[model samples]
Target: MMKYMKHLLVILVITIPVLYTVFLFGYHNQTQTTVIYHGINLFRGEEGGDQPLFEKREFTAPLSYVILLTLTFGIVIAAVAGLIWLLFSRWEQRRRLRSEKREERKERLYIEGIEYYFQGDLDMAEKIFEKVKARFPAFISPYIRIADIHYRRRDYRKSLELLDQARVNEAKRVDIFLRKAENFLALDDLGEASAALERAAEIDPKNLTVLEYQRDLYIMREKWEEALEVHKEYVRLVKHRRPEMEEIQNRLQYEIARKLVASEEGKGKAIRALREIIRSEPRFIPAYKVLGEIYVEQNRAEEALKMWEKAYKEHPEHPILLTWIEDVLYEQGAHEPRMSELYRKALEKSPHDRLLKLFYAHYLLRLDRVDEAEALLGELERTGGRLPLFSIFRSEIYERKGRFKDAIKALKAAYGIHSFNEMVFSSGNGLFEHPLHRQRTVSWYTWDRYRINTGQELIPMPDIQRVHRA
Candidate 1:
């Protein structure tokens, strides 16, 4: 009803002005008197002189100009409105095309930058992204990409500054928080990392990536109990029972146990936790190692060896148990005979375990029993021990026995062009990677000062000195 009223009011407003102007222009003050027949012949001079020749009738009505004027005015208004609409439509179309082209250029540059990034050209990728960002500052992707370039360049502070400069809602963007957390972690700012992770988790509580980052943050902080909790949530959120996830959870449990062993009163709890972990995963090397160490700390060497022996029964020729055994008993001042008997027993149990045989040979060379190591290496060769490490070991044994020529021959065999980097090795830290270790091992903050008291004496720094194999 109001709509009709507004339209009617507009028509009246337009038509009223047109009707009034037409009335003024069409109206005139003129005499329009009718003549009487008795006085009509005064001005007659023709054959019809008696006729009232000039009698003028009074105006009955003025022509109706209101409708005509109103129509003309309406047509004029419509033509002007249509012209304005046509021009506006063209202008809007051109503007839209320009905007689309601008967006396309931005997209093209972004794709080009991404391609360079994938091709491992960080400098070119960064330059292209800088151009994109300068021209299209509102684009979030360019900012992220540029920050990533800084991160890859190890300019963590610059990456963080760019993230801070992003004109976006930080709390609402889980990815931003995640990247910020990564930068903070790179800088070893655990507190800032934790805060970013917490904010990310708040934004996306069930996100697996967020939980993983949270778990990592806690692990870096050495808050094993908290890390364990976060890991549990990650496990719960995961849809599949992946071996990797199970392995990670087991490591978290081990770390928690390790932490508990830090305090005098927490030893028993730590011990129980370690035992529980071992029971759940008998082959988990770190739990066995740590538990054995703890038992040795409590003057329980017999028990430590007994526990390892139990696990060795399940995986008879496993290198981790043997190596841990070697380390522990060496600290116990293991003699040539004692260590030999240990290997001999293991070799007898797994006669065909080539890796085991290689390990034994390596151990012999370490003991400077060159003849025994050579005999074992010869046996390995006879059995087609094709492992590249076999050649490395062969070279070591040959060098030990004053066969420099043969040592060089063996060394050459290990580093063919394609196989130069094939024999790389990294030790496991139990069921997971050792916490907070990369580019360094056992950082000072996590390293136990009194490791000697816990039956973990320092082996020499050159425990596995390189012969320049790689």
Candidate 2:
């Protein structure tokens, strides 16, 4: 009703002025003579006669002029409106096309960047990514690609900076978090990596990728307790949502067992965890290995030997079993008589391994068979490369033969390849005795002090010496 009233009012306003003008012209031009009714004159002129006072009234109305003016003004207004609409439409189309072109160019650059990355041309990839970023400042692909290039080049710090620079809207924040976590993991920054994963979990707690990364980070940090907690969270996350996720379940169970054993402060807990893992996954060699190590650490050499024997029964071609057997026998003070037999058997099993030959040589030297050890070392030298322990053992052999210079040279060679930090090695029986312990202190900040301590101890500075020559 209100709409109709408004329309009616508009129509009255438009027609009133024209209608009044027309009425005025009609009244003046056409005389309204009073018609006599019963000899009475109505609306008469001033004179008594019909045309006495008012001479014959004659006026012209320019109706055609008004009609022509109205049509001309209507055409002009219509033309102006049409021109404005056409200009606006053209501007809008141009703007849309520009946007579409920009999107296409960004996509093309993104593809090119990916290709360059795959080709292992990180420089080219970075260049392409920068171009994409310049062309499409709103695009996320460039940041991701550049970060990946940095990561692949092992410039982890730069990669992390790139990841931090990534822009993520509400819709893409979860993805950004996951990618950031991946970059942190690549850099071995477990704490930050775990935090990123946790953020991703907060966004989408049921995300399996995020959960897996969290678990992996915990494991990398050697935070077995935290790893178990993450495992439980993962279980809760996927509960009933993916009931058929058997692979996830199995992996979670295995990792749980591993973590339980790792965090165990007592031998009882370690043994229990190991037994549970074996029952769950009979073929898990790591479980058996850890159990044997725990036994050995506790001086239960017989039990450790039996565990290795069982492992050997399960896997007949296991070379590490022989290594363990030799270790146990050496610990039992039976290395002299059994050294030759063990070396011969191990060599027969794996003849091409230089490390095996080196170990055999060490045993031979300990047995006072210097000539035999020399022959083995010579054979090892004939091969292409040296084993991790070969140089140290060789140095010991040289020192025994009263060749102090040769002994020092061999020790220098060993130090040059893998710098042995005295603090790290001395604090807790060193790398070889307890390799897993090193995992807990993998941070540069923690290990940096160890290297400083090594420097203080006057440990050989082979790297520094080389730098001086250069």
Candidate 3:
């Protein structure tokens, strides 16, 4: 009801003025007055003739019609001006809404492009970013994002070109310089990368990301001291230390120590550095391993054994340390009792560890404890152990026991699991069905060739050799 009333009021306002004008026109003629004039000669003959030749008549309108006409004209002029103003206001509103919608579309595209970029779909991200750039030329994010994509593709020149376009503003942005630094670093232009990063640092001195980039640059140039300083700065700025930061610092020290170990004079320095690393991070196994090796090279057998034993006690699952310890003990002719006890104790601690069980079984075999080794191998087989070496060891156990058929079966199983087969066709063709095993045989041959080219050790198959001889 209110809506109808509002519309009706508008119609009334417009119609009232027109109706009043119509009423005034209708009544004006009825109320209008006419005046007539008669003139006589008062001057000479010329004046009398001029006066008689002319008779004057006049009509006068009422005051109401004159006022109505003036008022009607004013109303029409005001209505026209109001209409124009209303139209212009609506047009302006629509233009602003269109601009807002365009901005919204550009923002959505940018967000999608970022998602694709992180998901590793560089091509799709580039296309979307390019569309955004075309549609919204002043939106700087798309230009920078596209440049980053080009940087990832290693198209450094194209990346720089896009970055240049993004840098049209007078003041340089931190992100723009950071991206330039990344591109220069990828191209191995360390000096330019450093310069760009420094400029970024100047713009935002406390930025952790810029500091991280500077640290990486220092590491790349092998300036460990500088890298460490920058890393410390980064930690200070971030206000919280990350575990990886410590690891990176430890690795930097390790490398420095490794380089020092090259000279006899620097061996002492290397040892001191290694000791420092171990003191800081006791669980750092590589430092202990290297330190043990250094002791062995120096003929300090007792020292090497002590260091390795400490490492094994700390991290019992480290197979390399176990193997190294076993080798050293065997070389010293003291492996039988000591190494066996060590393996048994490790197995007790980590009973379900496959690598530990396998190593223990191998150690048992070395000690001529065939029954124990066979029991472990049986457990491995039942539990679906897929390592080819497991099958190979099982075959070895069978051969030692003089179970020729079982030995052959185990060898065939090992062959099936074996990744490389350079000798498969040459020595074991009788074991495999000719046509059925064709693809498997070819795949094995290809793998064998790859292993040989890559200098990987081939899997041992002693039973296959015996079968070939038979």
Give candidates' CA RMSD values in order.
15.9, 14.8, 17.1
Compose the digit string of candidate 1's lDDT tens values, residues 1-470.
35544755687688778776666666653323333233234556667656775564443344444344457788688757766776787799899999999989989999999999889899999999999889987787778887888988989999888887673634377788888887886777778988987888888999988887777666656677897888888888888877667666677787778777888899999888888877776766667878898888999987888777768878773555676666667678864576678778887878887767766776766677788878988887888845555666676667667777776666567555243234442222121121222224321223222222222332212211111110
Which segments of candidate 1 are over 4 A away from where they belong? 1-101, 167-171, 262-264, 294-304, 319-345, 352-470
lDDT of 3 by residue, 213-284 (tens): 777677667677787788778877787776767766776677677778888888898899899989887766
- Global fold similarity of model 3 (TM-score): 0.54
Worst 10 residues of 3 by lDDT: 461-470
Cα lDDT of model 2 by residue, 1-470, tens digit: 35544755675577657766765675556634332223334557566564343334433435544444565577568657766766787799899999899778778878888888888888888998998877776677677678777766778778667766775423346666776766675666667777877778888887766666666566556555675677677777664655324333333444455455555475576577677766666554556666777777778878977777667556644444556676667768875566566567667767886656665676666667788888888777767557535666677677678787776667667656343342222111221232322343322112121222111111111110010000
TM-score of each: 0.56, 0.54, 0.54
Of candidates 2 and 1, the better by TM-score: 1
User: How far is 458's C-alpha from truth in model 3 (Å)?
Assistant: 26
* Candidate that beats the other on lDDT, 1 or 2, i.e. the better one: 1
| Model 1 lDDT at residue 11 | 71
Model 1's alpha-carbon lDDT is: 0.69
